[model samples]
Target: MSARRPIPGLGAAPSTDLPVLLPFDRGKGRTPDIYLATRWLASLPPWTPLLILAVMLAWPLVAHAQGRYAYSDAFDALFRWMPFLVFEGFFFNILISFLAMAIGTVAGAALGLAQISLNPMLRRAAWFITQLFRNSPWLVLLFIVLLAFPFEIVIGGVIIPIPDWMKAVFGLSLPIMANISEVVRGAVQSVPTAQWEASESLAFTRRQTMWQIILPQCFKRMIPPWMNWYAILTMATPLCSLLGVEELITLSRQAMEGEDNHPELLVPFFGFALVIFFMYCYPIARATIWLERKYSVKL
Candidate 1:
């Protein structure tokens, strides 16, 4: 090779990767922002820990003082007390919500499948149920459930004696089931015709194509939405307290006495509400994002 002659414009372009690895991003693979922040953090190592400590220490007081903490307080309190309470009040709530979601999911999928089903009765029934629940208000449905009967009214008065707790369960279930039916319907419908076609090529029943191929993938897409709705349900638990159920919000208010009447006591009680909310949600939010990144093909 000839001695390298100076070549105009031959200088190498700057590489994005740096010599130093980031603490949080070292095992996290590549993220340019993370690396940049890491380098900044490494250059001033003391600030990172100090800042985190400052944030943790400051969270409660900021809420007490009313500064850049209104949003923070809601979450901070949630993480702090959510564990002891969320599951406690909603021990039954989760059960009922999950059951409703399951029933709605199955029913919606059946209808979606029914749109392609061989049986006319199955198809008609699915559509009818969907339309009926869609037009009805969940709160009204819940009220109707509460007053329905000693023996639960099954369409056309089938002989099913419903328990009180089960009646509450049914009441909560109605709207949730209705909404989730639509969610599941959309998710099932979103699966490509190609995927269904491939499954069919393999001699899969429409049900088999849905269960094995479509629903699993559809569920992943459904998670963030489900978590959101689930949070809404948690917030709405106080409404159930209207029926004299002793839930967390009920307890928090019981402690508050009144927001306008008692400021000092309200702070602690408000703190109580904050604690309950964050305990369940903040971690779940963090974990949900982590899960989405970890499991999501698109991420």
Candidate 2:
């Protein structure tokens, strides 16, 4: 062969004996920047929530010292209403979260499986539904459900009243269902094509292969995201207060009103809500991180 010329500015050609590396090859074995940031966040001290609670608790006292309000008054009011807030208000919020999560998980899993159906029409329909709700704002979905659904259902001359809280649960479940569907689709698709081919070689039908082999693999992978969504749904439960659901935020506002709507009580009352929610969600977040690490697939 004739002598090969080097490309301009490159000076010399690389040796054929050396292995060629593609641009993406440089990224191999390196953790993603997003993963590092997530790790850093997960490493936060367990006492961080306690520190936040302390700060909130001390806020009323600071305001009192500044001559803005009475510390004892706010403390006494908060203490007196603690049982109501926790038992009735906060518990109601937890109940709504549980209901919404359960409904969402079941519906989302079905929708997700449908998205992977062999039938083109079923898959397309599932895709359309997933994208529609997944892209819709949660608050807007809540409002739509609130308006579109009737207050009661008449079943064979029986009037079954649908409570606002029930409506809130249904509304919240819609977007959650959409998201979990995507999670399921992604987890199922993540399985190696070899496994599917191996099942096919064994004369297994697609349904049998999926249910017996693929779905079982996806369960562990789906858990962390499922928990993360639960935390998100729990936080979003407060949005139902706008729809007149008697959840935590609604009851907190009612408690503040009962306490003469004092400006001083604002920090103490709302602060307690903040602290309790953090306490509930923080452990869940920690557990999700642990599970994610444990279940991460090694390439």
Highest TM-score against the true fold, candidate: 2
What do the candidate models score in CA lDDT, each in turn? 0.56, 0.86
For candidate 1, give the lDDT.
0.56
Q: What does candidate 2's lDDT look like per residue over 96-142, in tens digits?
A: 99999999999999999999998999999999999999889999999
Model 1 root-mean-square deviation: 12.5
TM-score to native of every candidate shown: 0.53, 0.85
Clashing pairs in 1: 77-274, 77-275, 78-274, 78-277, 78-278, 78-279, 79-278, 79-279, 82-279
Off by over 4 Å in 2: 1-44, 60-69
* 104 Cα displacement, candidate 1 (Å): 5.2
* Model 1: per-residue Cα lDDT over 1-299, one tens digit each: 56775554464443445585545656568533312322232244333444544664555566565444354444444455446455665465555556555555555555555654568897677667766876686667766877764655576766676765466556665655555656666677777889989999999997788789988878887675455445544444445555555566555554344223333344444555554444554445454455545544653
